[model samples]
Target: MKQNRLIQNIILLIGCLLLNSCYQNEEYMQTVQQNHLLIDIKDSGIYSNEPISRANTVGYTTTFSEGDKIGLYAVKNGEILPDVNNVCLSYTEGKWVANSSISYSEDKVGAIYYAYYPYDQALSTFNKTSTDPFEALVSSWEIGNDLTGDIYTGKDLMTGFANAKLEGRNYTLDLTLGHRMSLAVIKLPTTTYNFTNAGMSSYNVSPQNISFTIGKDSESEAPILPYYDITSDTYRILIHPNTAYTLKGKFTNGANANKSYTINIGTDIDKAQYAQYIVDQPEIINYTLNIGDYYCADGSLVSKDGPAPSNCIGVVYQVGTTDAIKNDYPSCNHGLVYALKRVEGDPIKWSTSKPSSTNWYEKYGMLLYNATGVDIQGYEETKTWMDIETGEVEGVDINSIMKSTLNDYRQNFILPSTTTDWYLPSYKELDALNNNATILNTQFSKVNGEALWTSATKDISYWSTTIRRQDAVVQYHPDNKTKAGYIRDSSGYYRYSFGF
Candidate 1:
C-alpha cells in the first residue's frame, strides 16, 4: 500500500507541473497593447493649431506634473467603461499621462481616451446634456476680477479637451486649449505735457508701477493683478471673458508722489467677447489713455469744462430760493439754488453761535469762542434742532448766523458775491447731500460749466450754529456719521467753513 501511494504522488506532481507550463505559454502568447495620448492648446486670440508648451502656458509657468489632477474616460468594446475621475496624471520625463489603471490593458486597442486639464469634475461620468464638460473649478482668487468685480481676469480659467481612439497598440491624441477671457493689450500713449504748465506732468509717472482695474460700477473693491509692461507705453492685464467692466487706472508720479494719477477707462467692454471684438476692429478695443485724461484738482479747472472730480463736493439738491444767482441758472424758472461745492480743510473752530465753555450757561444770544464740553453721546432724539421750536439754544435763528458768516468769508477772500446765502447745512441737510450725491453731481454739471470740489484742502474746521451745549456743531468733509464732525474745543482760530 505504501508503494502504491508514492506512485500516485509522483504522478500528481508531474501533472501539476505540466499544467503550470501550459498556462505560462498561453500568457506569453497574448499581446501587450501600448497606447499614447496627445495634447494641443490654443489661445482665443491666436488660434494657431499648436501643441501647448511651457512657453505658451498663459497664466502659469509650468504644465501638468505628477499628482496634477485630470479628468479621464475610456471606451472599450464600443461601450463606455467606468470613468477614472480626478485621477492624478503622472509626469515621466516631460510628458504627462494617466496611470496604467486608466490607460493600459492587453485588449484595449479599440479603447478611446478623453482627458481635460486642471480637472475638477469626473469627465468619464459627465452627464451629456446637463453638465459642462469644459468648465474648470476656478476660485475667487483665480478670477481676480477688476475693481468693479464684474470682469474676470483671463489668466485663471485655462481649459482644454482631447479625445482619441487607441489603434495598433499606440495612438496620439491632438487636443486644443483656448482662452475664455477677453484680451486687452493696451498701449498707453506717451504723455506729452506743455513744460510751461505748472501742474502735474506725465513725465513723473512710473510706467512699470501703473495699476489697471476693471469691473462693474458697484464693484468698488480692487483686486491686485499681475501686469506686464511690454514697453514704457504698453501694458497688458488679463480680464474675465463674458462680462462688462468699469476701468480705473492709477500710477504714482515722481513729481507728485503724494498725489495719485488717475483716469477713468470707460465701462463698455465685454471681456468674453474682447478677443473677437479686437479681431473685428483692432482699433476699437486697443485703447490709449492720454496723459491729459488724468484728473486734476486745480481750482482753475472748476470753471473750464467737464465733470467734477469725486474729491469735490457736488450740489446737495435744487431748492426754491430768490438768490440772484438762480436768475442766471438754466433752471431759472424753478428759482433753484445750488449748494456750495464741498471743500476740504478745517475752518473756524470758534463760533459766536456757541455758548461759553466755562459757564455752560444757556442764553438766547451769547457770543462765544470755540467752546468745548458739549456731550451728546447718548442723546439719540436730540440729533438736530429742526424739531425743537421752543428752546433758544436749539431754536436760535440759523439764517441770520449763515448770512453773517458767508459775507465775512467772502470779504476775507476778496471774492465776488456768491449766488445764494451760504450757511452751515444742518446734520440732516448734510446727510441729504451725501445721499443725493448722484443727482447733485449731475445737476451741477449741467448748470455749472466746470464743478470740482477741493478735498481735504486744509483740514478746514467748519462751524455749525446748531449747538447742543457749550459745544457748537462742526463738520469735516469725508467725516462719518458718529464722530469727527462734532467740535467741543474752540480755543483756536477758525480756518474753514461749509454752506448749503
Candidate 2:
C-alpha cells in the first residue's frame, strides 16, 4: 500500500508541473498578440521663402542636440497611463533613448507616451492618474507658460506625442515635433556710408553689434534676442509664434549710442521647413528678419524709397495734391526748407481779413480752388495739401507774399528751390500739418518755431475757411479754435508760414 501511494503522489506531482508549463505557454502567446506602437516622428521644416515639402521623420541615429530637451507622452482613448513609466527621451550618442526608469522598445505597439526636448518640469509629476491627453498638454505646456525645474534650463521647448491603441501588428504613428518658440534671423550686409563729422560728410566705419528687441515695446511679454547664424550668415532670435511683433534695436555711433530702431514683422510666423523627412534635424525656427534698405537717424529701419536726396534733412514731407495743383509729385521728398521744430521769438502777422478783393485773395484764392470751382477743405486734407499751383497765380504770387511778410529774423534764410519751392498753404495744407502732428513731433522738435501758420484769411469769421467763403481766414493752432480773424493786412500780430 505504501509503495502504491508513493507512486500515485509522484504521478500527481508530474501532472501539476505539466499543467503549470501549459498555462505559461498560453500566457506568452497572448502577450505576443498584443498591439505595438511605432512613432514616425516628423518635422514640416518650413523656412522663409523655401518651398514646402513632405514631413521629415526622425531616424534611428537621430537625437536632440546638446542643450535641447524633448518631452513626450502616450495616450489611449483619453487617459494618461501612470504605469507606462518614461515620459522623457534624452539625446545620447545621436540616439533618442528612454529614461532611466523605462526600457526602450523596438516593438511597434505599446501604451500611450508623451515626449519633449528640453523636458517640461511643470509636468514632471504627470503619470497614470492624469486623464485627457489634449487637455493635459494644453494646460501644462502652454507656449508662453513657465516651465520650472533644473531639467528645463529655461531654454526654448519642443514637443511631440503618441496615442495609445491596441494593434495586432506595427501601428505607425506619424508624430510631428513643433517648437513652442520662434526665431528671428537678421542679416546686415557690408555697406559703405558717408558720415557727417563737424558739419562735413565723409566715409566712416559702419556700426557692428546692434542690440534689439522683438516686440511693440521694451516691456513686451515676447522679447527677442539677436544671435548670429553660421549656416545662413545672418542674425537670429527666438520669438513667440502666431503673434504680431515689432523688431526694435539699438546701435551706437559717436554720441548716439542708444538710438533705437523699429520695423513690423508683417504677419505671424509658422514652422521652419527643414529637408524632406531626413535625419539630423536641428530644433529651431529659421526666420529671416528683414532690415529694409535704409536705417533712419531715429534708429529705425526704412525701405529704400529711391535714391536718397542730397542737401536735405532726409525727412520726406509728402504734400501738394489739392484744388489747383494738378502736377504729379514724388511720393516722398527731402525736408526742403525746414521741419516743424520749436523756433523761438515773436509770431509774424500774415495779412488783414479784407473783403474778397484782387490784391491778395483773388490771385492766391484761385490757387486754393479747382478749375471747375471746388473749394479745397480738410475733408481729405492729406490728398489735397499738396495742390498749390504757382502757374495759376493771376496777380500776387504766394511765394513773394510769404517772403515779404516773414519776420526779419528769417528774411535772408535759404529760399526753397524750384523742385522744393515753399509757399503759403491754403486751408487744406494747414489741416494736413495738424493731422500729422504726432509723426512730425517724433522726427523733429524746435523750441522757437513750433507754431503753425496758414495762408488762409477769411473776410467774416473762422468758419469762413471751412465754407470756402470770402478768403481771409487764419488759425493760431491746429485745432482751428484760436484765431485773429479780424486782423488787418498790415497786422504784425500774425506771422507768415508756408509748406514745401
Candidate 3:
C-alpha cells in the first residue's frame, strides 16, 4: 500500500510540471524575471517624455506633492479585470506608489490601461466620449474656482489611457495626462476706472459636444460663473471641450452699475483641446460721439455749432473714451474734451517754472515730481495736485482762466456742470487725445480752438498728467507694435482737459 501511494504522488508532481509548460507556450505566459507595473506621470500641456520637474508643466497644473491620488483601470479581453478595477495610487516624494500594485499575472498582462487623477472611491466606472478617438467623459468632474480653491488641481481635468496592443510580462505605460478643457481669460479694460468692484450679471453654459459648435439647446444650459481673480483683475473660466457659454459683465460703481455688456461665447470661441479664448476688448458701449461738440467745463457735451453751455472750456476733438470711462462720465458723451489752450501758455523749461520747481519736482535728477497715488480718473487727480489747494496747481489756474480770461468759455465752464469739476488728463486721457489728433485737429479748426497737435508736441513728447517715480509716460508717435505708445518725455505741455 505504501509503494502504491508513492507512485501516485510522483505522477501528480509530473502532471503539475507539464501543466506549467503548457501555460508557458501561451502569449500571456511570462518568464519569471519580470512581475511589476511601471507607470510614469506627465503633463500633456507641456508635452514631454523624459522626466522633468513639475514646474515645467503649463496652465494651473503645479508640481505634484505627496498624497496626490491617481486611479487606474486595467481591461483585458473586452472587460476590466475584477481585481484591477479603479486601483488607487498615491504620489510620495517623487514617485507614484500603489496600495496593492497590479502584478504581472497572466490575467493582468496583455491588457489595455486607463488612468485618471484625483481618484474618487465612489467612481466605479466612467463613460467614454468617443471610441475612435478614445475620449473619456470629463463632464462628471465639476470645475471649482481656481482662485478660491486649490488652484492647481480641481479647476483642471486630465486623463491618460492606452488602447493599443499589449503583450509583455511587465506592464509599462507613459501615462501622459491630457487636458480636456478650455480656458477663457476675460480681461476688463484698464480704463474701466469706474469698476471699484466687479460682479457677474449673467452667466450661462451648455453641455460640451465633440464638434466645435454646440447645438441650440438653451433649455438644457447651466449657469456657471467664471472665477474672478482680484490680483490679476481678470475673469477665468475652465470649460469642457466645445462647451458654449454666455457671459454678461456688470461693475459695482455707478456707471457699470447702470450699464452691462453681454458676450455670447458660441461658435466664435476657440474650442480646441487645451485651447485658450482670446484676451481682447470684446465690445465697447453701443453709443457714438461726434468730434467737435462744444465741451462745457462741468463735463457736458453740446451738439456741434450749438450755443455753448455756461462755462464752456473747449470742444470735443477726440472720442476715445474707454468703456469704463464712458461708464463714469456719460455727460461728456463718452468722449475726451481738450482745453482751448495749454497751461502757462507755451511749454516751459519744466523746473525753472514755479509749478515745476515746487516740492512737486523734489525728486532729484529727474524733471517730473515723485507724486505718488495720482492715478484717479476724473476730478480726484486734479483735486490732489491743485490739492485746488490752488496757487501751486494748474487746476486752480485753469479754472480761474476759464471763468475770467477766456471770455467765450467763462459762462460755459460755469453752467451747472454735470461732471462737476475739471483737471489735467491722466496718461490714458492724454493718449486718447493724441490717438485721434487728426480728427481732433480738424474739429478744433472748425470750432476756433488751439491746434490739438502743434510743432511743439510733435518732435518731442508732451508732459502727460500721468507721472510716476521720475518717469513720465507720453504718447510717442512710433505707431508700431514696438513703439505704439508708452514712452517717457522730458518735454511737456501742461494742458487742461474738460471733466477727465
Candidate 4:
C-alpha cells in the first residue's frame, strides 16, 4: 500500500507541473494580445526644411493585461520586443495626411487608425528621460481640435496641425512645424524731427516698426524687432505688448536755417508748448558774407579808415567817369574819374604855380599847349609833339588810344595770357572801363581833361548796354551785367604776336 501511494503522488506532481506550464503559456499569449506595443510617433510635417527625430517615451505602463500585451505586439510589423518589463500602450498624433507617401502596415489589429497618435503621455515620458528639456516640445502638430478622427494605428497626422495627443492625453504642441510661420506684424508710430547746420537741413526718426509672434504656446519667444540708433541716424520701432515706446523724431528744414522741432508720438502732444520749447531753444543762424579789405577808389591798398566805394568794386566800374591823368600823373591828360572822391591825407594841397609855368615842365610845355589847342583841324593837327618829330605822325585819337591800351593791358598783364589765349574783354568790359574812369575823376584831381568812350552803342531807344528792367541804384549799373566787359575804338594800334 505504501509503494502504490508513493507512485501516485509522483504522477500527480508531474501532472500538476504540466498543467502549470500550459496555463502559463496561455497567460503569456493573452498578455501579448491585450497590451499593444506603445510607439510614440513624432510628426515633423510632410514638407519640412529641417530634420526631425522619432518619438521616444520613458516609464512603461504597469496596468497591462496578458491579452493587452498580445494586442500591442500584434500592431508591430516585426518581432514585438518590449525593452522594459512593464509594457504600456500610448498613441501619437503625427503630422501625416491621407495622401502621404509613408508606407505602413500592422500585423495584428484590423482597426484603421488615422494619422493621429497620443502625444501628451509620450511628451511626459520624453520629458522625464530626455537630456534636453525642450526635446518633448512637439516640433510638428495638427491644426484642428479633434485629433481622434484623423489618427491612424500606423500613420502620422496631417502637416500644419497645431493640436495633438500623447499617451491618450490631449496636448497643445508649441512647435515650429510649417515651412513658414506668420507673425503678428505691428507698425510702430513714427516721430519726425528736423536738424539744420550751415544752411542745410535733415529729417530723422528713432524707431521704424514693431513685430511680435502670436500663438497658443507659452514657450514661444517674441520676434526680434528692428531698433534705431541716434548715432547711426537709423531708426527702427518694434511694436510690442504692455510697453510704452517712443519713436525718435526727425525733420528737414528746406531753407537749411537753424531751427528746432519737437517730435510728438501720439495725438496728445501740445503743439503750443512744443513750439514754445523750440523757440526757447532756438538754433543759432550763421550767414556767410563775401567781403574784403576796404580801399580807396583809386585801387590803392588801404586800412579800415580808408573810404569804401558806395557800390562793390565790380559795379563801381560800371557807372564811373574817366580821368585823363589816371595812368601818368603830371603828364598824361587821360584817366578814370570817380564821383565820390577821397584824398590821400587829411589836408588838401593847392599850388600857386601853374602846370606850364613851372621850370620842371619847360620841355613838354609847348607840346602840352599844342595838344590842348582847340583850333587844330583834321587828324594831322591832333598829332602829338613826339609823333610829329619822329616822322611817325599819326592822328592822336585820345579815345582810340585809351581803348587800345586798356584792351592790351587786360589781355596781357591782367590775365594769364599763356593759359587763356583768347579771353578778350567783352562789351561789358567797355562799360566797366567807363565807370572806372568816372570813379577816378571824382576820387583824384590827377584825372582831369580826358575823354573816355564806353563800349555801349546807341540803339533806337537808349544806350545798348544799359540795364532796363530794374531801376534801383544797385541795378542801373552795367558792370553788374553777367558778362565780360570790353572796349572799342576806330583807331588801329601796333599789334604783336608771340611765337608759339
Which candidate comes out best when scored by lDDT?
3
| 2 against 4, candidate with superior TM-score | 2
Task: Indicate the worst ten consecutive residues by lDDT in candidate 2.
Answer: 274-283
lDDT, candidate 3, 1-500, per-residue tens: 88999999999999998898788765344554256666778876632111343334323444678888888877676677776778888898788888885666666656777777777778844643234122434655566433334553555666678633333655566687766666555555431222111221111111111012122226333444555555655556665555556554543221122234455555433222322333334232222346666654333345665554444467765544434344655533344567776654544322321243234434322223224533325333443343323344432231232223223333444433344344556555555566777766665665556665577545434444334432223323324211212121234455666533
Q: What tens-digit string does per-residue lDDT give for candidate 4 at 43-123?
A: 242221112311321111112122221111111222222332112333214321221122222333332221223323233
How much lDDT does candidate 1 score? 0.38
* Per-candidate TM-score against the hidden true structure: 0.34, 0.35, 0.38, 0.17
Worst 10 residues of 3 by lDDT: 202-211
How would you encode candidate 1's per-residue C-alpha lDDT over 263-314 as one tens digit per residue?
3333333423322111111111121222112122211112113444442322
Model 1 ranges off by over 4 Å: 1-70, 73-80, 90-92, 104-114, 120-131, 135-142, 145-155, 166-169, 189-209, 229-235, 253-500
* Number of the top TM-score candidate: 3
Question: What is the lDDT for 122 in model 1?
Answer: 32
Global CA lDDT of candidate 4, please? Answer: 0.25
lDDT of 1 at 252: 32
RMSD of each candidate?
Answer: 19.9, 24.8, 19.6, 35.1
Off by over 4 Å in 2: 1-42, 49-63, 66-68, 100-112, 124-154, 163-174, 192-207, 216-224, 252-260, 271-500
Better of 2 and 3 by TM-score: 3
Q: Write the per-residue lDDT of candidate 2 for residues 48-119, one digit (tens) a residue.
A: 423332333211112346444455665554555453434555556555544543322443145556655556
